[model samples]
Every structure is written in C-alpha cells, then in structure tokens.
Target: MIETQDLRKEFRDGRTTKVAVDGLTLAIPPGRVTGLLGLNGAGKTTTIKILATLLRPTSGTVRVDELDPLRDPKAVRHRINLIAGGERMVYARMTGRENLWYFGQLYDVPRAVLGPRIDELLALVGLTGAAGTVVERYSRGMAQRLSIARGLINDPAYLLLDEPTLGLDAPIARDLRRVVARLAAEGKGVLLTSHYLAEVEELCGHVYVIGDGRHLTEGSPAELTARTGGHRTVRVTVPGASPEVEAAVTAFAARAGTVAGLDRAGDGALVVSVSHPGEIAGPLTMAIVGAGGTLAGLEVTEPSLEDAILALNDAAWLVTA
Candidate 1:
C-alpha cells in the first residue's frame, strides 16, 4: 500500500549538509504491520513525517495507494492516520467524548455517525467509563487511549503509529498491542515505529532497520535472524560428572557450523552454541555420548529480535559476511 524509492531527506546548515534519511527504498504491504525501528536520532521520525504528508522528501518518490503525497496532500490525508510518538493527546480541556466528536467532525464524519463512532472507539480503547470526563483530568494512559480513538475518526486505510505504547504501563501497552493487531486484521496497512524491539517483533510481520541515516536491512523477523548467522546457544545441566559430554559439544560445534563460543561453570554445567540450532539435540547428544558423556538435561535457545538488531548495527559485517 506504500512504496518509496531512494527516499532522502537532507538538512543544510552553515557549511555542512546532514542526511536524516538516505537511499531508503521500502514497501509496506496492505493489512500488515511494518515496523520502522531504530535508536533515537536514527531518522524514524523524519521518515514518518514525510510519509504522513507533513514534510516533503528532499529527493526520490513516495506513493501511498498510488497517490503522490506531495501532489495530493489533501487526498493523502483523507486516507491515512498518524498518531505521532509522544504526541497522541486530546485537548486537555475537552472531555474524551468531546475530543472524539470534534476530531470526527474534522474528518467530516456525519454528526449522526459521530456519536456511535465515539462510543465504539472509547470502548475499544478501554476508556468507555471516562468518555464524559474532560481529557485534562484523564491519566496518561487514558489520554493515550483517547488519542488512538482520534486517529480512527476517519477510519483511515493506512495507520502510522509512532511509539503507540511509549509511556503506557505494561497492562495498557498490552492492550494497545491488541488494538493494533485488530486494526491490521480489518485490512488497514500499518507503519509502526518504536524503540521496543519485542513489541515490534510481536506486532510487525516485516521490519526495516535504519542506521546512520541509511537503510541497513529489511526482511521478516525470521529472515533477518537467519541472515545474521549467529550460533544458537544451548544450555545443559547434568547431575553427575560427564567428561565425554565436553568433547561431544566441541565436536558438534565444529561440524554443525562452529561452536563460536562456549561457557562452562562449576557443577558439571555447560553452555554451548553451535552454528545451527537444529543440530543441537540429536547431533550434539551423540557427540557427547561418543566422548562418554551422559545427558541429564538440555535446553535450546533460538535467535531473538535483539540479536538481529545487533547484527544490523554492526556496519562492517553487513552485506559482507
């Protein structure tokens, strides 16, 4: 639903020019959550602003649903909703219901439909009880919920959520995640940007990692994990002494890919990482036994989103090895 080719945004100072985003080519599919993840000052906000039609890209082309945002800003606004990070708050003086009603009116939602939409969104975001209370009195979580309701005022086809769960408590963050999933399931294309790697992994089917104002990598969570080629770590603790087990792990490491790293603690415990996690149990076990080791317990560790992100951060290793 969204595509950008060689997107670049540049800022000029007295003598130096800085590129906030450079050569960023990306595609966000319909009915899927696509995460734009990066650390602070990594150009996430700049990218989102350009996509939302609030800022024009310095170079390249951007199309949302085949509409050029720069040429048809009005039409683009009608089709997208952007709940900016740290800024999804309603008018503090207006009641939650009033805030929703006002935003709905701006979206041209008919007065007859406004009431029902307000009620539905308030309930959807778990703010039904505070619908009548002024936003100024609402807690941070309540205001965040109301902001979400405002974003849905137009029932937008594309949702741009920048840190939707930034300041919420755990419970509220979980609730927001559920809401985000439901929106996508309803066929809304979503571009979500957040610092929370776990949240992005849970919500986004695909992700684009940005670093140093450039596109570092883009792929599904599993695909990116596989590309990193980091060894999968396995931890084992056996009750009795087993010298054979040590030899087995080393041999499995060599054949499976590379042990890469190993850590042994007191009490006959071993932590082993082989090039591939799939060979951890069967091949590793046999090797341990051949060395006269008896297995008492075994646990496998798979690559996480954090591991993939770390690999993205290492510029020297990217697209090289």
Candidate 2:
C-alpha cells in the first residue's frame, strides 16, 4: 500500500506562506485503481509529487510499499513512478525506443531483458510503428502515450497517474485507461487523478475526494453516491398519454409531495427528477396508471460520482467559508 498520515506540504515566498496540502490521510492499495479527485489547485498534484519523492512534505509520514520516501527516496523512486498529464518528461530529440532504453538503463534493467521489454511496451502503448520516430515529430496524444511507456520502463510497484488522459481524444484516452486497469490487475498499486469523473467511476474501485487540500471523503463511487442520496432521474414510458392523463399525473405528483422537475423525454416518456427515488417510484407509477397512461418501462438513473463529489466539496467549503 502507498499511504500517508496527516500529510502536509507548504511553500513560502518571502514573507508569504502557502499551504498546498493539509492534513490529508490517504491510502492506495495494490491490485486496484484508487481515484484522487479534486478541483483545480486542490493540492492533488502536490500530494502526488510528495509521494513520488519529487517534493518533500512539510510534515508527514509517507510510505510507498513500506518504504519511506523522505528517508529513502532512492528506494521509493525504484518502486513508484508518477505520470502527470500535460507534463512532458521525455527528450524531444530522443526516439521513442531510445527514450525507453535510456530510462530502462537508469533502472538497471538488464541488457538481456531491456530489449524485449522495450519491444513489449512499444506494442502495449501502440507506439511500435513509431518506435524509431523522434519524439518531437509525435503528436500530443502520441507523446502522452510515450510518457506511459516511459513510466512503465521500471515496472514500478506503484503508479501515480495525475490526469493521465487529459487533452487526449476519446479513443486514445480510452486506450490509456485500459492500460491503467491492466497494471492494477497485475497488482501494481494505481493512484489515478482525473477530472473525467466517468473514467473514475468506471476504473477506480475506491475514491478519495479532496477539497482545499483537506481529505473530504472516501468510498466506492456507489457508496458515496448513495450516502449523498444523489439527485435521481426516473424515466418511464408514458407513451401515448392524452392531455387529460398528463394533467392527472402532474396533479398526483404535486399532491404526492414534490420532486425537482418533471418533463417529457424526446420519446414522449415521462421524466421526473427527485431527491428520493425510492420513496417516489411507486407513487409515480401509480399516478401514471391511474391517469390511464401506458407504462411500458421505468428506469431510474442515479446521480454520477461527479455529482456526489462536487456536492460534498461545495458543502465542505460552505461550512468553512
């Protein structure tokens, strides 16, 4: 596990001091993808840098695979790698293969295995054909792919991906996501930070939401959303309803207390937003039935992980403000 306890990091410029990370306790276990979520300047990258041994925490205990990054940065570096989106860690003049070979050699990957490892990684990241191409000639997406290849050269036990998919087109982003999942499945502890909430929902088995450098909450996406009782939308096939039936259903909904909004979907289905779908689903169905509307189907869409995290973050800031 990669873990931190009451982690704190600060920067001082002249007489002014800025706290970038504050009292954040987090854990990323192996064999799973853990999401690190926060808005801009929420200390996400700073926290990652600390764990990656690129920045020392102002005060805290950080351990990567039971190795102290502060006390033994060299050992920590061998076991962990941090890849940040929009950050170019490659040399423009180096060919993709040369970049990998250089990094592999740095990690002491043996001469015998280095060649095969480079070939395998090149294919893994869709860079095989471009292996001999100078990195400066590669597009942004291809360059980002090379970063992934570079990060994996050491086959570190822990991978920290901060916005790994940022700015890439959908197809390329998806390919990288698969690579992340594959790494975790191989028991590499993976900590992913991305603004793409849906990606988090799909990939991360657990999530840590941070705000203003504070650990706001942690849970599986479903658990977090359930805890929030997230805004839900229930769409029912109220097909071929007459004006009278629609009016009856509206009146019934009003009397049944309330929901956030009610409207017709493009297919003329009834769509209703509610704070508590569990309490309202039955009444809604009955209303449609009594109003003589055909109910062929009903589906409740729960609020996304993004909604839960943002709502919780807003609440926390409101309390502090």
Candidate 3:
C-alpha cells in the first residue's frame, strides 16, 4: 500500500548538505504491519514525514496507494493517518473525546459518523474513562492514548506510526501493539517505526531496517534473522561443566556451522551462536555429555529483531566507515 523508489531527502546547513534519507526503496504490503527500524537520527522520521506528505523529498518518488505524496498531497493525506511520537502535536486544552471528534470533523466525516468514530476510538485506546477530561491534565500515557484515537478518527486505509510507543509503560505499549495488530488484521496497512525490538518482532510481519540514511535490509523478521546468520542462538544451562566441557561446546558449535560468537551468561551456562540452526541440538547435547557436563536446559531461540537490526546497522556502518 506504501511504496518508495529511490527516495532521498536532504537538509542544508551553513556550507554543507546533510542527507537524512538516501535512495530508500521499500514497500509496505496491505493488511500487514511493516516495521521501519533505525536508531535515533537514522532517517526513519524523515522517511515517514515524506510518505505522510508533511515533508517533501529532495529527489525520487513516493506513492501511497497510487497517489504521489508530493504531487497529489491532498489525495494522499485523505487516505492515510500519520501519528508521530504519540502526543507531539495534540492540543492540550481539548478533552480526549474532543480531540478525536475534531479530527473526524477535519476529515469531513459525515455528522452521523463522528459520534460513533469518537466513541470507538476512545474505547479502542482504553480512554473511555477519561474521554471528557482535558488533555492538559492527562499523563504522558493518557495523551498518547488520545493520539492513537485521533489517528483512527478517519479510519484511513493506511496508518503511519512513528515511535508510537516510544515512552509509554510496558502495559500501555502492549495495549497499543494489540490495537495496531487488530487494525492491520482488519485490512488496514500499517507502517510502524520502533526501537523496541521485541515489539517489532511480535507485531510486524516484515521489517525494514535502516542505518546511515540508507536501507540496510528489508524482509520478514525470520528472513532477516536467517540472512544475518542470527537465528541459531542457543542457550544451554548445565548443572556442572568442566573446562573440557566448555571447550567441547565451543568445538561442537563450530562444527554445527559458522560460529558467530559465544558468551557465558551466569553460573555454568553458555550461550552459543551458530550461523545455521540445523542439527544443533543433537550434536551440542552429545558434546556436553561426552565432556562430563550434565545438561540442564538446551533451548534454541531465534535472535530478536533488535539483534538483527543492530547487526545490519553495524554492517552498514562498516561499509561507510
């Protein structure tokens, strides 16, 4: 539903130009949550602003549902809802319900549609209890909840969320993720940007990781993990392990595939990284036992999206450095 081809954005300072986004080419599939991940100042915000028609790109093309955000800004804006940093620009004097109702009116939603839209948004964001309270008295999380409600006021086909859960509590963030997932499942396209790796991994079907103002990688979370050789992180806890047993685990991990790295977490536990996951369990179990260590737990975990993105970011930095 959202596509960018060679998208670039630049800013001019005194005597130099800084590129905020560079040749970013990516797509967000309809009815799925596609996460846009990057460290702070890594062009994620720039890209989202361009796609939302709030900022014009320096070069290249961006289309949201076949309408150019730069050329057909009005049409694109009508079809998308862009919420950034949760409460960035919400009016403090209005009540939570008032905020959504105002947005619904701005979208020119029918008078008949406004009441239900406001009610549904308030309920969806768990702000029904404070629907009439002015936003100035609301806590940070409450205001954020209202912002989410505002984003849904028009029921736009595409939702562009930039750091939607950035500073919220764990419970609040979890609620927002569930709500966003539900929207995507209901056939709305969602493009999300987040630093919380677990949140992205849990909610996003595909992820586009960016660094150094460029696209580092884009694929399904599993696909990116597999591509980074990051899927085979194994955590093994043994009752007691001798030096020989540690050496054996290392050797077995090497034999399993490429040994990316290894570390020990706590008491007699070893975390090993294998490039590929195939046949890791049987060999590692045999090796530990053969070297006089009783296996306590041998569990395999896929590396998280954060880990994969950091790896990709490191690789991108290496290329430019």
Model 3: CA > 4 A from native = 240-247, 250-278
Instruction: Please report the TM-score between candidate 2 and the true structure.
Output: 0.91
Candidates by TM-score, descending order: 2, 3, 1
Error of 3 at 9 (Å): 0.7
Question: Residue 201 in candidate 1 has what lDDT?
Answer: 86
- Clashes per candidate, residues 3 or more apart or on different chains: 1, 0, 0
Model 1, residue 253: C-alpha shift (Å): 3.7
The better candidate by lDDT, 1 or 2, is: 2
lDDT by residue (18-73, candidate 3, tens digit) is 99999999898789999998888889988988888888899999888788776778
Cand. 1 TM to true fold: 0.87
TM-score of each: 0.87, 0.91, 0.89
User: Model 1, range 1-321, lDDT digits (tens) per residue?
Assistant: 989999999989999998998889988878999999777778889998889898889999999999999889889899998896599557999999888888887788888888888888989989999888988888888898889889898999999999988889999899989989988998999999987888998999999988866888888878877887754666655445355566666666776666535556576456554546465666666676677666667777777878888867775345535
Q: Choose the strongest candidate by TM-score.
A: 2
lDDT of 2 at 240: 71
lDDT ranking of the models: 2, 3, 1
Q: lDDT of each model, Cα atoms only? A: 0.82, 0.86, 0.83
